[model samples]
Target: MGVRMRLTTVETVHEEGSWLFTVRDQYGADEEVVLVPCEDGVEAWINRCTHESQRLDTGRGAAMRDGQIICPKHGSMFDSCTGYCDNGEAAETTLPSVDVTVEDGTVYLTDDEVSYLRDGGIDEDEDEDGGPSSTSHLSF
Candidate 1:
């Protein structure tokens, strides 16, 4: 099992419909994950689409319909609970799912690397030390 990290409270998660959270994997790489409220509890998956690696939400809340997550770019539908894409160009593919749970009113992302700044955007500006420092403000 990977590290477990508290993301947000259940109430907050439902209030926002869905929450996008990022984590740093063991290799020090960032991964974007989104948490969606479901009937059983909460479902979490990577924010990218399976077809062309586009963002599923593009900074907006995930578009859901008939218990499926809709890809804005390709109009593909993925089962929210299972991440399986049974239609559209992404057939035979699945959105990467991250394990999560709502415990004591708090949502926790588990069995994965937890880093909050993975999706903070890249910094093309170099610092005084000749290394990239964030030139733009971080967004989502």
Candidate 2:
């Protein structure tokens, strides 16, 4: 349902800086991909909230709560380290997560993604059935 965009190369982001990439699927929806540098190499995550499809702001979503991103809308928290969704109260489901690997200092978004059953087969995170890593779910 979303349009997948061509993966571009970014060469200036630092350790604490974030690189944003947009992936447009076939449905015209542009999924926001963010590459966050972690102590353990690099991590890839979709910038969307698991609840109401809110675009998760990299700055506000993830706060320094022992290290994780919290959804400002519903207070749903997700571990940026692993893209695990644990809203403030208890851990519920997770959003769509993309596999990331860095080579030659360039971060690439792998083809690895799970499909959400509701979106005619768009990849959803393993934990959240209908929720997408980004707006991929809403696009469809």
Candidate 3:
């Protein structure tokens, strides 16, 4: 068990399809995590797709269908509950897990490798100027 930091309410995650948050890893690098509703509770995964660096949820929310997280890049589907991809480009890969727990309707960040920073992706103001945006490679 690690430091339990409050994230957001479980109901909020369900309403948003997914919740995005930022955390700082032990190495001092910032990472994004997404929370999606599951059968038992909410599951958190590193925001990027397993096949590439594309973010699964680009701030607004992740595209979810039939309980799976849909990759916006190549349409790969990952199980929201398990983060496992059985088909498409991401097959055989699992989204990096970020340990989280839900208790009394509120979510908490419990991963020892990361410390909660803030909600949503890294702020643009905090990013290096002139650096490419995360979605710059997308055709749309």
Candidate 4:
């Protein structure tokens, strides 16, 4: 296991509907990860729909119903705990997941392929400023 970097809290994930965070992949590209409440705890997945590469959470929150995350583009519902999509255009597909662990009510980024960058998606000025913004609506 690699170093676990702090992401967010379980309380915040529940209170905010969802939590979005930025991470730098092994290839040095920024990727967004969304944390949603699950039956057990919070589960983190790459913030895009599998079928169309559409963002699941568009700076607000991913539409969820009955413990499933809804794909806004195609209405595919993904199991929040398993990342599995059993119907719609994304049927039988699973959203790419970003490994995370909850400890002491806090969430940490544990995926070896990525490193925590900031608490939001790719910022508008990220390329210009060389980093993410300190605050964003998508963040906790």
Candidate 5:
């Protein structure tokens, strides 16, 4: 399990929508995770779409319509609670889920593998901004 970092209180997050949040990994790297409201509790997953590898919440947050995370590119809909994509082009595929725990109204990532989708799967080379780039190859 990774360090239990506080994400937010349950009161602040609503059940009808999703929130795109970032957390640092064990190596102190920023990882993008989406916190979605579910029936049992809040669920977390990597922000990348399973079909085309695009950020699920890119332009206007996640496209959460009719209880599904609809992929903007291919319109693949994933269940917010189970990370199951049973519709659209990527029907058999599922989004990568992040380990999370909620205690005392606080949410946290509970594994050392937590991380944002790194550009090129993660490289040590620093970009011009003096920081690692989060860009990743997207197949269309």
Candidate 6:
């Protein structure tokens, strides 16, 4: 089954060079989605690191090390400029991105990708491509 997702809101960050906006997914309710700014645009992924969903809870947004947000949970480093790989640890696990488009100066995340963005989690054991399961912490 395809993952379900939705565009929730927009968040902005102030950097030395630019003011960036992150298109947040509806997946995370009390949790924050990580935003890595890039030259092409912005790379938005679920803040939860694939290795463990702990750093996201600890408020380590992008896991920055030496001004870079490397997930503290796994030391995974992504390009703050393109959301790609700085060290490339879990190549199979993509910093999952939702389909986002801008219209009228507003960003919108497609509905098809919203479910995964929710605070809910999936059984990683069953689906290799699926995200961390939040069933134990089910909030719905």
- Give the candidate number with the greatest lDDT: 3
The models' CA-based lDDT, in order, is 0.69, 0.51, 0.85, 0.83, 0.65, 0.41
Clash count per candidate? 2, 21, 0, 0, 4, 22
lDDT score at residue 100, model 5, on the 0-100 scale? 78
Rate residue 61 of model 5 by lDDT: 52
Q: Which regions in candidate 3 have their CA more than 4 angstroms from the true location?
A: 123-140
Tens-place lDDT digits, model 3, residues 1-140: 88999999989888888999999999999999999999758999998888887778876688898899988768788999999999888899999999988899999999999999998887534435512344323332
Model 1 lDDT-worst window of ten: 131-140
Error of 2 at 77 (Å): 1.8
> What TM-score number comes out for model 3?
0.86
lDDT of 6 by residue, 1-140 (tens): 34323333233322421121233345554334544445434445555555555333233123344434455444565555444554545434545554555444344544353433333223223336332233222221
TM-score of each: 0.75, 0.57, 0.86, 0.85, 0.70, 0.46
Q: What is the lDDT of candidate 6?
A: 0.41
**Model 5 off-target regions past 4 Å?**
23-30, 115-140
Q: RMSD to native for every prediction?
A: 8.2, 10.5, 4.1, 6.8, 7.5, 10.7
Clashing pairs for model 1 are 23-115, 24-115
- Candidate 2 lDDT, tens digit per residue, 91-119? 57676767655666665555434222121
Error of 3 at 124 (Å): 6.1
Comparing 1 and 4 on lDDT, the stronger one: 4
The numbered model that scores best in TM-score is: 3
Which pairs clash inside model 4? none
**In candidate 5, residue 32 scores what lDDT?**
68
Candidate 6 clash total? 22
